[model samples]
Target: MNPLVEVSHLEKHFEIRSGLWRTVSSHVRAVDDVSFAIAAGETLGLVGESGSGKSTVARLLLRLITATGGSVRLEGREVTTARPAEMKALRRKMGIVFQDPAASMNPRAKIKWSLRRPLVTNGFEHARIDDQILAMLAKVNLGPELLNRYPHQLSGGQQQRISVARALLLRPRLLVLDEPTSALDISVQAQVLNILLDLQEAFGLTYLFISHDLNVVRYVSDRVAIMYLGKLMEIGPVEAVLQAPRHPYTQGLAASSPPMSPHQRGRQRVLLAEQPPSLIDLPTGCRLHPRCPFRQTICEETRPELRELAPGHWAACHLAENLPAPQPRDT
Candidate 1:
């Protein structure tokens, strides 16, 4: 089946200007040659530490920001080159829930107006707007009583639910969930996540779930992509990538995460020897080569493109085939 969303060689570089002239001094490679696809109703988790360009990828997919190069196709429609009208039409099929729900809303606006704004902008009928909003509110487990209150009046969880409702008001096919539960309390997080899952099942929604939290991704994602310095290191089934990580960077991430079980606490952890390279002055060859313990002369001098390593697993590492299996089991 064709992917609901397909991204190909997408690149976004931010130009840095300095001195009086403001001429382009350098470019921060925010996203470089990244590509992935999201199948219908499948949640693809994008995991990485801060500044791995996960959020940037989300914006690029939504056309919230322009990409420097490459293509994005939604339901096989080319998004990068679409005209304003075409792009506007495409916007209805996609919705984004940000990391901070309160900040995404207008603080002065009442919840009703905030919820109604999208439908109104999209030309939703005035008479039916209230009914639609109420229905959506019910779906997110929110009630109509809070509609009259301002954003400041709602709890973090409520605010987020409202955000979800607003995003789904248009009945978008794809939902970009950018750390939807990170800000709430652990209990609230669980509640919000359960609601999201319920809603996804109810709506048959396809998700691009982005978060730095490994545990959250593990819980919510069907397939997981591990990114480093604007590049994908490994991508595969959640268990394949997380439990038996192929790439060194992915191994480090899996090892560093809080162990899933008490028995697994004795497993040896993988750690990178150095820090991530600066994005503006990214090293040639492999971006993670500086910190990679298995780096050889070839690794330092040449970059490795993603290659199939297992039935459904892919990794961008030269040594992936030769590396011993990761310790999800006692060695």
Candidate 2:
């Protein structure tokens, strides 16, 4: 089957300006030559450090911002060059739940009013708007009483649920969940995650789940993509990538993650040194070479393209084959 979302050689660069005239001095390579796809009903987790450009990738996929170079197709339709009208139509088919639910919502507006905006803007009939809003709330396990309150009155989890409900109100084919549960308590996070899983199963929703938390990503993703300095270092089945990571960067991430079980506690850790390279002045060769513990001379002189090393698994490291298997961790 064809993929629901396909991205190829995606690139996004922001021009840096300086001086009184504000001339373009350099460019920050926010997303550089990234590529990946998501099949229908599949969740592809994007994991990386704070400045890894994960969120930029999400925005690019949604056409929330224009790409500097590359193609993004949604269900065989080219989205990168879609016109305003076309994009407006596409918005109904795709939704995004941002990291901060409270900020995404209006503090002054009641929940019911906020939820009704999409239906109203989409031309829902006056008589059916309330019914639709109520139905969506029920699906997210929210009650009608909560709808009368402002966003400030709702708990963090409830606000997030409202955000999810708003996204699903349009019945989108795909959803970009940007750190959805990060703002919630642990118990609340589980509830929200379960709600997302149940919603996906019921609605056949495809997801681009982005998070820095490895354990959360492992639990929610079918496949995981490891990113660094605006590039994808590794990507594959969640179990394979997390348990036997190939790229040195990915291995470090796995080792740094908190072990879920006692058996994993004995595993050796791979600690990286030095700060990430600046996007404006990226390293000459492989971006991670400066901090990579196993780096060789070739690593500093040449960059390696992503290559498949195992069935359906790919990594962008010249010495991936020679590196020892990543210590196993509970998933």
Candidate 3:
């Protein structure tokens, strides 16, 4: 089956202006030659530290920001250079849930208005807007009673549920969840996650879930992609990437994650001695080599392209073959 979303050779660079003349001094390579695909009804979790370009990837996929190069296709239609009218029409198939729910919504507008706005903007009949809003709310386990409340009146979890309701109001096929639960408490996070899973199952939704939380990604993702310094470091089935990571950066992330159970306590951990390289002045060759424990002379001289290590697993590391296999974790 064809993938629902396809991104190829995507690149985005922001020019930094300096001095009185405002000449372009340097460029921050936010996302460089990144590629991935999300199949129908699949959740592709993108995990990386802050400034790793995960959020930038989401924006590029949605065309909120134009890419400097490469292409993005949605449902077989090229969206990279789509006209305004074409993009407006494509909005129905894609929705985004930002990290901060309170900030995403209007402070003065009640939940009812917030939910109704999308449908109204999309040209839904005024008479049927209420019915549509209520149905979408039901999918997120929210009731009509909270519709009159302002964003500040609701708890973080309630606000996020409202955000989800608003996103679903358009009945989108793909949802880009950018750290959707990062602002909520741990208890509330679980509730929101469960709701997301239920909604995906009910709506046959595909997701590009972006987060720095590896444990959360592992829990919700079918496949996981690890990124660093705007490049894809590793990607594969979540179990394969998390349990037996191939790239050094991925292994470090997995090892540093808090163990889910007591039995995982004794697992070996990989720690990097150096800090992450700067995006503005990225190092030549392998970006992670400065901090990678398994760095070699070849690593410093050439950048390794992502190559398949197993049937579906891929990693971009010069010493991927020589590194010891990561211990398998219970799925």
lDDT (CA) per prediction: 0.88, 0.90, 0.88
Candidate 2 lDDT over residue span 1-331, tens digit each: 4599999999999899999999999999999999999999999999987788999999998899999999998988889998989887887889999999999998899999999999999998999999989998999999999989999999999999999999999899999999999889989999999999999999999999999788999999999999998999999999899999999888877885453234543442335666687999999779998888888999999999999999889999999999976666655
Worst 10 residues of 3 by lDDT: 260-269
Task: Report the Cα lDDT for residue 136, model 3.
Answer: 82
With a 3 Å backbone cut-off (N, CA, C), the pairs that clash in candidate 3 are none
* Weakest ten-residue segment in model 1 by summed lDDT: 260-269
lDDT of 1 by residue, 1-331 (tens): 4599999999999999998999999999988899889899999999886788999999999999999999999999998889999999999999999989999999999999998889898898999999999999999998899999999999999999999999999999999999998889989999998999999999999999987767888889999998899998889999888888999888877775453234543442345765577899998898888888788888888999999889779999999988877767222
| RMSD of model 1 against the true structure | 3.0
The lDDT, on a scale of 0 to 1, for candidate 3 is 0.88
lDDT of 1: 0.88
Cα lDDT for residue 102, candidate 3: 90
Count of clashes in candidate 3: 0
Clashes of 1: 0
Per-residue lDDT of candidate 3, residues 279-313 (tens digit)? 99998889988888888988888999999999889
